[model samples]
Every structure is written in structure tokens, then in C-alpha cells.
Target: MQTLRSRQASIAPLGIVLATGALLTGCGLAEDIADSLDTSNSKLHHVDTGAEGKESGLLADWVPDDAEDVHVLQRTTGSERLLTFEYSGGMPSECLEIDTVGSPTQEELAAAYETDARTRDFEVTQWSTEPTMQAEWWSAGHESRTTHLCGRWWVSETEGVFHAFAAELNG
Candidate 1:
């Protein structure tokens, strides 16, 4: 009787330990799945406006020298990146001077600008509703760097607001 009771005691504790381990593992797996499904949780966003915005590396190579009241928003998820900006004091005609591929189609614009969920919330959406013109461009950075750029602009006599998007083409 004593031998049987001792064996039973050992088996009960072993069962408990196994059950606890299984529960912990199940919880961990559930958490991982939730993280994978919620991409916004993993995204990184950066906002810069005015002179500081122009100085940022994100905007420095992109924004025109004549731009003013600049507002820039950048979002990144892993290797993917999206950029949008608004500025005054630049000419719509300047699109020709930039390294653009000429006017963008409605489908191309949607793919570049509307694909990201986070970008939908940006203030630039308000300005994009009625753009005077739109352009698309590509920047093949030095060596192994390549990026796709697209943008739209609403122009007036005193202000020219531009909303642009950029993403890594190879990444």
C-alpha cells in the first residue's frame, strides 16, 4: 500500500507540471498569432513639419528647396516604408523639374497612396480630395538602394500642398 501511494503521489505532481507547461505554451502561441494579425501595432511613425521637416533625412532628398510650411509623415513596417508631405511656396510646374515619370493614373495613385491602413488617417487625405495634378517617380538609391515614389499636388496662387508616398522597391 505504501509503495502504491508513493507512486501515485509522484505521478500527480508530474501531471500538474505537464498541464502548466501546456497552458503556458498555448498562451504564448495565442499572443504570437495576435501580433502577426495586427500589423499597425508593429508600424513606426514619424512626423516632422516646417524647417525641421526639411532637415530630416526622410525629407531632405525629397522636398524641393523652394518648399515652405512643410509637413512630413513617414511610416515603416519591417522593410516597407510610406511617406506623405504637404508644403506651400512651390510650383506645380516644378513637377517637371523633379525626377518624375510624368502624370500618374488613378489606379497607380490608389496603389501608392491608399494601400496602407495608417496612411488613411493622415491629414494629407483632406488635401488629396481635389488635386490639380499628380506625378510618379522612382529613386534608385546608391548601390543596392531602390525606392518607388508617387505624389499628388493641389495648387493655388499662394500655396502648393503636395502629398507624396515612397516605398522600398526591392525590400
Candidate 2:
């Protein structure tokens, strides 16, 4: 009985310590980087606009471009890491593409295509969020105020993957 009690007490403290560490570090929500310029020696950059800005960034700067209302974040899964951009604008049914560099697979590209196809019907209205950006949209009569059409594009070289996740959400 004493051995069992000792084991339980030791395990309980260990579990609590691990949980505290995880919460303190925010386990997995992407790194909290900062706004940056397109320089040779740089990490990540935000365009104040999210996914749309990512597409536009490809058209102009190697990073983010003219993104006025967008937020970008970086997420990781195991050994993989991807930059996620969430965007909202004044227009609807806007479809844009982003040029990928480094290494990625065709399946990754297909995921992005699938995401776009699914979101075609939703009329994007408002997109707001920072640090970790999220896209939001609404319908005509607000039947479904928030639509899954609003999503973030996750891309990264670590995983050699690029995908758009139209998160399941409703308003």
C-alpha cells in the first residue's frame, strides 16, 4: 500500500509539471513573430492582411504585400512548420493564387485547390484576428453568418507542404 501511494504521488506531481509547462508555452498555436521587412536576413512577415495578402505578396514582394487588413501566423506539426495567412477584404468571391518556392508536393497544392473549391459559395464579409489570424464571412440574410469559405493558407518548407484549411465555423 505504501509503495502504491508513493508511486501515485510521484506520478501526480510529474503530470502537473508537464501540464504547467505546456500551458505556459502555449504548446501549439504558432510562434508569435513580429512585422518585418523583406530583407536577405529575415524570418517571417505580416501584410496586415492574411491569405489574400499571401497571394498578393507573390505578385509583388517575396514576402507580404499591400496587405492592409490581414494577419499571418506560423504553425508547426511535429517536424513540419508552415506559415498561415488569414485575410478579409471589402470584396467577395475573390480567388487568388500564391507562388510557392523551396520544396512542396502536388498533393499539398491539391489541398489548397480543394479548400478554394469548397469556399466558392460563401460571400466573405468580415475578417478579423491578430497574432493568430482567422477569416470570417457572412451570408445575405446572415442565414449562415459565418462561412467556412474563410480560412488560412498554411505553407512551409519544413514539411514541404502547402494547404488551405477552410475551418468549420458558423455564425
Candidate 3:
């Protein structure tokens, strides 16, 4: 057998400690915060945009129905999490992760939302439990189109943005 040329790259005890500490240093009950970031360098915004919100004209074959107080707006041009919130029963009751476009980082999409003044302090994360596949642009000379669920929530000194967004999406 050949001699080992390099050391294994396993997480060291000290490295683990630092990682854990960094992960734990956030707002809320210290849950899985990664689920809220659309990307590492982006955040979510929550405000009353009168527009339909998230242009969803690219979906191939999809039919979404309105949930409790929120209406699903799948942005075919990008991810599906970009939907409309029609709160008839006051604030929503759960968070949601909609599908969007395949390419580009979620952080890019999140940066688009930073323009909103209603959403000043917070971040966005994408979460999904369903199985997904990598897809690509057929005519554009790509391989596959990856389908994933995403969410956007604003974090702040006070729990206002994410809480309401979760409520809307769940319903």
C-alpha cells in the first residue's frame, strides 16, 4: 500500500467549537438560521407592495391555488417563494418556501428586495425538504433546471418581518 501523503481533512475539535459559536450567535431561539438566508450576502424585506409581487410568467406547467390568507405567486422568471400576501384574516400563521428560477444565487434575488424601506434589518434563507434535480437552459445551452423551495424573512432587533411572513406563507 502507498504511504499516506496528506492528513485527513476532518473538522477539528476547535474548528467545530468556532463553527457552533458562529451559528449560535443570531436572533430568535437559535434555530436553523440557514433556512432564512436566500444567500450568504442577502436579506429579506417585508412591506406592503401594492403590485402583484414576483413576476411568475416563466413556469412551464404549474397551477397554484390561494392559501388561507396568502395567495401563491410563483415567480417563473426566478424562484417561487416570491408570492403575494393577501391577509384577509390578519397576519399569516406560517412561513413558506416557493420555487424560483434555476440560475443565479438566491442572494442576488434578495438584493432586489433590499430596496424596500419596510424591510430594513434582516436576512433571507432558502429551505426545502422535497427532493430536487438539477435542470439547465435547453436553448441557452445548459444542462438542467434545479427545482428548490425558498423563503425570505427580515431579521431585526424586534421580531416583526419574519413572524408576519411566516404567518402569511403558512396560511
Q: What is the C-alpha lDDT of each candidate?
A: 0.41, 0.33, 0.29
**22-90, model 1: which lDDT tens digit per residue?**
668785755667667875512333455544555655453335555554433333332233334455645
lDDT of 2 by residue, 36-77 (tens): 322322133345444355565422122233324333222221
Worst 10 residues of 2 by lDDT: 137-146
The local lDDT score (0 to 100) that residue 74 gets in candidate 2 is: 26
**Candidate 3 local distance difference test against the native:** 0.29
Model 3 poorest ten-residue lDDT run: 162-171
Candidate 2 C-alpha error for residue 129, in Å: 25
Candidate 3 TM-score to native: 0.19
Cα error, residue 166 of model 3, in Å, equals 22
Off by over 4 Å in 3: 1-11, 27-84, 87-171
Which one wins by TM-score: 1 or 3? Answer: 1
TM-scores for candidates 1 onward, in order:
0.30, 0.28, 0.19
Per-residue lDDT over 1-171 for candidate 3, one digit per residue giving the tens place of the 0 to 100 score:
443443323446668777778767854534555445434322233334323222333211111222122233322223323223333332233322224423325564355334333222434333221112222211221111322212233111112111111101111
Give candidate 3's root-mean-square deviation (CA, Å): 18.2
Best by lDDT: 1
